[model samples]
Target: MEALTLYQLNRRIAELVTNSSTQNVWVTAELSDVAVRGGHCYMELLQKDPDTGATVAKARAAIWANVFSRLRSDFYIATGQDFATGLKVMVRASVSMHPVYGMSLVINAVNPEYTMGDLLRRRKEMLARLKAEGILDMNRSLCWNEPPLRIAIVSAEGAAGYGDFMNQLNGNQLGLRFTTRLFPAIMQGERTAQSV
Candidate 1:
């Protein structure tokens, strides 16, 4: 077998990936890590086995600045929720391989309505199953304040939402002071459980 330079091998792989799959594909994955920088949103996507809860696959994904704004706005409009970690999402992405980065997905669009439906169905199913098992809302027995004053915001450092929240806090008209601080977060994957 002929030994090729690392770059040559990766370049050939990239070419193969590029040629074999050129169309946008819909994929379902859990966001393991998420970050936004210079208007671009980057994500780590993971697929876990349902029976064993073991992660079976993972990939690096990115939504460039151009596609991210429109996709995010549309998602909020359709789903009435901000895209965040711990949510399963169906995104339309194109697969690619990079010499330095290896295999990954480049997301250009997302079906927000589809994701919203998935979330709603999952919530309803969970509630029903829990109620059937007679364990639903077991936490209701705990005494807790109606509105928690201490709110900790965890997000990517340069995320737009974090910036907006800081601005809103600074511009609060009411004198009601709340102790709040943003704890930096890796919003996409398993690392978050360790950090926050």
Candidate 2:
């Protein structure tokens, strides 16, 4: 057997990934966090064991700021949900890997509807579990209709999703006034729960 050089190993892996198939896939997951640095937005997406609450799988993902900015605007216009930590999202991505990063998904597009479906599914599951435990309506319903005029919102700094949220609120015709405090949170991955 012959020893494979580092260059040879990388080339082989790249070729295998590139040649296997070309697919445009839509993936659904929870957005754990988003960060912007060096003209790119880095994201972490994850899923966990429903019963044990342990992470099952995770991926590092990214969007160039230009694409992210446009998507962020379009997403908000299409859906009222703010793209933030704890919100579910569906992304159309390309499978890719870097020598240093190992594996990542380069998000080319997003489908808010798909993400919403995932959220609804999770919501239903939680509702069912609560019903089984006879605690579905245990807590008094809290109305967030009149959110504190001074708000501490947790979101990704400079993220298009966050930007959209702010823009909508700021542009309200009623001149609704509020002071916003921004707190950063990881929007995806196992650590997302803790970050929030």
Which candidate comes out best when scored by lDDT?
1
| Candidate 2 global CA lDDT score | 0.75
**CA lDDT, candidate 1, residue 74:** 91
The list of candidate 2 runs beyond 4 A from truth reads 20-22, 118-196
Taking the tens digit of each residue's C-alpha lDDT, what string does model 2 give over 107-193? 879998886676689779989999999888765565666656787888767666788789988998888898999999765445667
Candidate 2, poorest ten consecutive residues by summed lDDT: 15-24
TM-score, model 1 to reference: 0.68
CA lDDT scores, all candidates in order: 0.80, 0.75
Task: Output the lDDT of residue 101, model 1.
Answer: 80
Candidate 1: segments with Cα more than 4 A from true spot: 20-22, 129-196
Q: Alpha carbon lDDT of residue 174, candidate 1?
A: 70
TM-score of 2: 0.61
Q: How accurate locally is residue 28 in candidate 2, as Cα lDDT from 0 to 100? A: 81
lDDT of 1 at 128: 97
- Per-prediction TM-score: 0.68, 0.61
